[model samples]
Target: MIMDLSKQVKIALDYIQSIDVSDIDDTSEAGRIFYEKFIPMAGEEETIYKIENLEVPSFEQTINIRIYRPSNEKELPVVIYFHGGWFNAGGLESHDRPLRKLANLSGAIIISVDYRLAPEYPFPTGLNDCYNALEWIILHAKMLGIDLKRLAIAGDSAGAALATVITRRAIQNNLNKILCQLLVYPVTDASLKTPSWQEFKDGPVLNYEGAVQAWNLYLPNIKEIENPDASPLYSDELSDMPSTLMIIAEYDPLRDEAILYAEKLQKSGVAVKQLLYKGMVHGFFQMGGIIDDGNRAIEETAQFLIQNFNK
Candidate 1:
């Protein structure tokens, strides 16, 4: 049984529920407008030593990537990040404040990808965009002054699924630059059949229907859920994957899937670290303003990434 939510988390969920969106379909034009305008509660912005935005051409369109360098040191370890919004809503701005904190705390260069959203761009499109962007960054690591030897990948929710998929793909192609991966409340299995899925169907933040809807919009073909390409949980090979830090929330619908994935990684000889925030909900890693654990998650993430870089 899940424990009671922390005072801060309860307050945050109450505030979110108070918002009026009775008529706005979250996937419609009005919904996108609302999400674009809804600046997630952000912490004070920190100025990293260097930050720049670049565009990489993808098969679908140009991918926009924001680069954050926390120091002037040459050949710094780097981590590529993908933001989570259930495969549709989040982008650079929605995640800027936390990324800055992550970069500053970690003292490593960060590259955050802005992949295409779904219901329009759909499955392989977003996945391909993320992969192509990483491929381009790897190709230009020297020019970007990054240490390819210490490269890592990180993401949350849908983004985490992408991160692991790419990590596996890299292993398959023998492109072994990714040394570690950090996943925060990752949504790994699309089957939505976990005990947590049944438990948190009416999520404090992420509900079951919304999750299933997002998957449907992102993946039109229902049968694709089994395609390991769509759900990393079904991937046959977890061996040779990078060291992993999986941050899970006890009250989250994705909890069981993430735990199962972490177990799979551990069984396959990959070093896996798991953190279960007792009272937290999905997407709390980016909610620093609302919960202290959010900032703590970033600090822990930085520590893990630094550990991998130092190794």
Candidate 2:
């Protein structure tokens, strides 16, 4: 272990060691299942009043979305959530508990977006699904009883990358309603050459080689690696972007990039708050089943949105 991980994470890693999915390609069926095993814990389901699945139309295909409403209050603020899976794995089900807890804690309706994965759908497809889903939500806000004027975008890891891209796209469209972001240990850069990436080269959870593989699977065109839409860290216009709450894990391979992005956001005069979890590794934010910090990340991150949304 590169860092002193939490006891909970230590035990969780021990269980991970017992699994045979390590050698499997992450985009493979068994590999995706391996990612989910880390966070086997469920949330306080009673806290959420409703969980419904719906679909959104995009140019390429129809994407699924799971809505989590803690209450039936009229015109509630909402958080559009994208699940983390390196743009290959992860889905609405894997991230359900964290979204539910955030919805309950923030008193905001949380919508989990089921954007398409990579190695099949690839770049722009998933991004398009997420961006179009946001547009759909904005257009149908009244019917859904959500306050379109108060909206936030959130995601972890690869999904977080999509969330940032979506927010940037929303800004370009002059959509000021999308005003806040909750990025949990996001993949801000596609270069995958940050110092932390090298530091955690062996990974307690995510490693540099694994990240490279994910990027390879995601971006079909190598020339687009530095494109702003493909990698938000390369985007020059950050001044008018949404106020952000960046969640970071100290031992994560992507740690330095998150910090760099936070610095960029601050330098651009955007409102930014960073919540760093010491003694933690990558993907810990959604591991509530094994570690208390997973839920703590949700609880702590909820207030940022609540305050931003004025809920």
Candidate 3:
């Protein structure tokens, strides 16, 4: 379908298209400037009850995490969040606005994890950091005012990919702490050969070339692209995964893989909610400050969280 872009998305696309990324390097100063320029800042939300910054001890280094609470509700459910940026860029500050909004809207505490990025830490390092953070959160749930049984994992793009990996690991270890996963246009397959990849290869936001670049930077070798840990879509088993809410963009190169993964999860008897935003491009979920659809998606996600947490 040739869906027309929403006004805000059109503006976003215009802004993105006008950028000169010819000299940009994904690992250097140019990447930093690009991230700062493109990633929308949501500022602050008045509804948030509290915000805290703390560190979690990981295998080789200390990982920083930001906690956002909507209200003074004790033992609130928690959403562990990982930010996008193709796993090479993005950190706590870049995603702070959405985290706060999520905290307030979902009536759950939001823990934004600042996991290590790629080309430096590489594939499993960031994933390992996320898993370790999950472990720490669960172990110290009480001290953090979190309800162990009401935990959820959430992320956008590469972060969504990491969330899926963490959820899979949690199931394999027989840990039932995670109740649901909120994935926003997740990068589920590293193959980068899907039909959508061909369709949106140039991207309104994320292009196929950029996607490949990210995977190359994240994985140690090309062969690792097929590893289920690196690409959750490659996993043979999807059964027993936590309930899932997947938000996909029709114009995103990663769209098809997200749909395929959701289908797989549903067929595996996992509860799945999928939203395909027509005319939307990748990363729309984080552009709420400019895109109306972004806020709507967030509201839907918050409702999903509240419903699942109540269940």
lDDT of 3 by residue, 40-120 (tens): 534344457889999999996699999998888799899999999888888987777777788888899999999998888
TM-score for each candidate, following the candidate numbering: 0.95, 0.95, 0.94
Q: Please identify model 2 stretches exceeding 4 Å from their true place.
A: 22-27, 42-47
- Misplaced by over 4 Å in model 3 are 1-3, 18-27, 41-47
Better of 1 and 3 by TM-score: 1
lDDT of each: 0.86, 0.85, 0.86
Q: Give model 3's TM-score versus the native structure.
A: 0.94
TM-score (C-alpha, index-matched) for candidate 1: 0.95
Full candidate order by TM-score, most accurate first: 1, 2, 3
Q: What would the per-residue lDDT of candidate 1 be over residues 42-85, giving only the tens digit for each residue?
A: 56778889899999999956989999999989999999998888
Cα lDDT of model 2 by residue, 1-311, tens digit: 43677788897778777777756664467767876765565434445899889988888568898989888899998899989988988898788777778888998899998888888888988999998899899888888889888889999998888999899888888865676999999898999879998888988788778878888888978998998888889999888887899999998888999999999999999989999998887877767777888878888888788788774
RMSD of 3: 1.9
The residue ranges of model 1 lying beyond 4 angstroms of the native Cα positions read 1-3, 21-26, 30-40
Best by TM-score: 1
